[model samples]
Target: MKLSFEYGQGLMDATLPDTTDVFIPGETVQDPPFLPNIEAATREAIEHPMGMKRLGEQVNADSKVVIIFPDRVKGGFQADSHRKVSIPILIEECAKAGVSDRNIKLICSNGLHRKNTKEEIRSILGDDIFNRFWDLGNITNHDSEDWDNLVDLGYEEQYNARVIMNKEVYDADAAILVGHALGNPYGGYS
Candidate 1:
């Protein structure tokens, strides 16, 4: 069996033993289309947000908005990619909420993963978003190694582990996470 996974700008091919059994999600799973029109679904979701008020109703002019998006490693770079389709809408809502551009920051939540390069950043976020935020220093990748940018939450006794998050996220008046649900090794979905 053979498989090809994306690695940087190129592809890395892998070969398994002849007797190996491989299962591809598309081939193994059969599910009806839940929401075929992503944009429409997103709009509907925004209209009736759960657990909180709408973006415009929640934020004020003085509010600092931080939007966290997944890195390229976890998602696709297609024209209709989640970030591409959703970010602009989020921004528009923020604008309607009177949150200025200066108060908004888009963080590529790479966590401990390798930092994405400029090209990868452009690929993950469409050119319009990249152009709108990158040059303004509003778009950035999270650096776990940068201690100053990390906020240390006191050790939790339940899991007996230290919890930490990005300082920008911690300091922001509102922090929103944008991502897709996919089967991953870390968990069944993220």
Candidate 2:
């Protein structure tokens, strides 16, 4: 068996023995049946989410809403990617709450990784979204080192972990995080 893996600026092809055990997520282990309409499904989830109020009930016209997305290395990057699809739906929900696009911001939660460039961001967010927010300077990459923009909300001695967060996220009236359900998208070690 042969496979082509994505490498630095190119592909790396490897040949594996037929006896080699290989497990590809959603392949070797089946995922649930695919949603026929991801956009509709996403909207439905937001409308009637469990354990929380609906998205439109969370904010208002004067609210500053920040949508946080994982950096380039995470998630699917297709035009119909989770990031691409879910973000628009989230913005629509915010709109339903009377939040204007002018009051909305997008941040890439890069953590310790190098910042993603405009091209990289555009690829991840798609042209329509990038165009909509880039001109307004509402899209930005997370800077963990920017002390002035970080909030250290006291240390948690029990967990031996400090609760540090980006001020934009902490201070926003509403903050939405788009990430993988199976992965821990928050907190990391330098």
- Residue 93 C-alpha lDDT in model 1: 93
lDDT of 2 by residue, 1-190 (tens): 9987666457899999989787666878777778899888987887898999988998999999999998887746787788999999899889888998899999998999999999999988999889999999999999999999999999999999999999999999989999774443364521
All candidates' TM-scores? Answer: 0.85, 0.85
Over 44-145, each residue of candidate 1 has an lDDT whose tens digit, in order, gives 787679998998888999999999999988867888778888888989899998998889999999988899988899999989989988888999999999
RMSD of each: 2.7, 3.6
Candidate 1's TM-score reads: 0.85
Task: Quote the positional error of residue 26 for candidate 1 in Å.
Answer: 7.2
Once fitted onto the true fold, the runs of candidate 2 whose alpha carbons sit more than 4 angstroms away are 5-10, 23-32, 182-190
Clashing pairs in 2: none
Candidate 1 residue spans exceeding 4 A from truth: 1-31, 185-187
